[model samples]
Target: MIKNAIYLLFSFFIIGCVSTKSTLKNVDYKATKPKIEKGKYVITEYANDPKYGYNKEYPINIGFANLHSEEYFVKLFFNGLTNPEGDIFSYEKIETCCPFPSNHNKMGVGLLHKYRVTFNNGTTKDLYINLYEKGEILCPNGFKILAN
Candidate 1:
């Protein structure tokens, strides 16, 4: 009986201290649109709640001129975006403004930046990038939005 009680206690302790990383495989995906600002692609279709501390990264806009490229999913069923030929810009790469973070961070929103993109075709273009603010998505490229 003592051994059984100890096992139960150990199980409870282990369970309490465990942290989990989530995978999106079981998540339901919905097709959504994106915005193109100064030759940069912005996925504004994502719905993030700031109340839950989900607004960690501020929007950083990276840009290049006359950018033309093909974008595809990094994996067959993954959450990353990549380009094999053209230029690729993602919302994940944004936000490098402020250092201090709190429940509210000024880093959550900031100014835009420009970048020069050299594509696989050896062509050069100027690009501009910015965060996709709520109700700020002007163009939609059919990006994917996952829902529970």
Candidate 2:
């Protein structure tokens, strides 16, 4: 009796997790800012202005190479992001989506997308490298937020 009830509860739990599907659409970003050479984009002097606070001046590029299709990648590059003071901070999540290349195969090359953010203390961070197809990124990696 108890065992049967536990099994039923476990099955419902698994079903709840499986019901959620990814709701992401492909994007064709317009060049609102100047393009960088060598396939990189630069965000210069972002801290100097308030509008670009979340995204500081940095360089980024998107292209195909040394990666596999259907595989999304998320990498974070930073200097002194962690501090002893532990001043907890939060930033809005950024989303980027790339379409699957036509030449994609089980073993195909990958595309790269760079999002660079520079700090006021001369620290720089790069997020979302080769994040093609679709990927999820949470900044200050491994930090989970509690829901209100």
Candidate 3:
């Protein structure tokens, strides 16, 4: 039908807009996976740069290459973090944006996930995550790693 043709054309246009070179600044293929304890990642370091997860160009790259489910790793990352006051936080996946090149996917492109994190005091922050690339897992500057 004409509608299906139009939809296909639109899809191609959108895919054509994706940049061939990724803008991500913190992808580390050699980064090792973190230890999981009690269903959470045991993150031991804090990000030195404030933009680590807040900026779309520097997403928290929890690669899916070796993992079976993306949400599993995402949950582990958030469960390993807490507010600065040492209180557990809650998060929700708000959106998916920022497509970039990646060899991990059949399409050779990947999208970034945006999460809204809420603390016990009602404070909130947005974090960008890339499940297609790997990086050193660390707590973002404004947050703290959950105590073991």
Best by TM-score: 3
Rank by lDDT, descending? 3, 2, 1
Candidate 1 per-residue lDDT over residues 1-148, each given as its tens digit: 9999998886566444433321111111232334433333444443343211122232221211111211221111112223343234333222322222111213222222333434445544333333222222221122232221
Question: Cα lDDT of model 3 overall?
Answer: 0.89
Write down the TM-score of every candidate: 0.23, 0.23, 0.90
Every candidate's lDDT = 0.29, 0.31, 0.89
Which one is best on lDDT?
A: 3
Candidate 2 vs candidate 3: the lDDT winner is 3
Clashing pairs in 3: none
Candidate with the larger TM-score of 1 and 3: 3
Q: Model 2: per-residue lDDT, tens digit, 3-59?
A: 999987865554444323322222223323322333222322222322221321211
The worst-scoring run of ten residues by lDDT in candidate 1 lies at: 69-78
The residue ranges of model 2 lying beyond 4 angstroms of the native Cα positions read 1-109, 142-148
For residue 126, model 3's alpha carbon misses the true position, in angstroms, by 0.1
Error of 2 at 57 (Å): 24
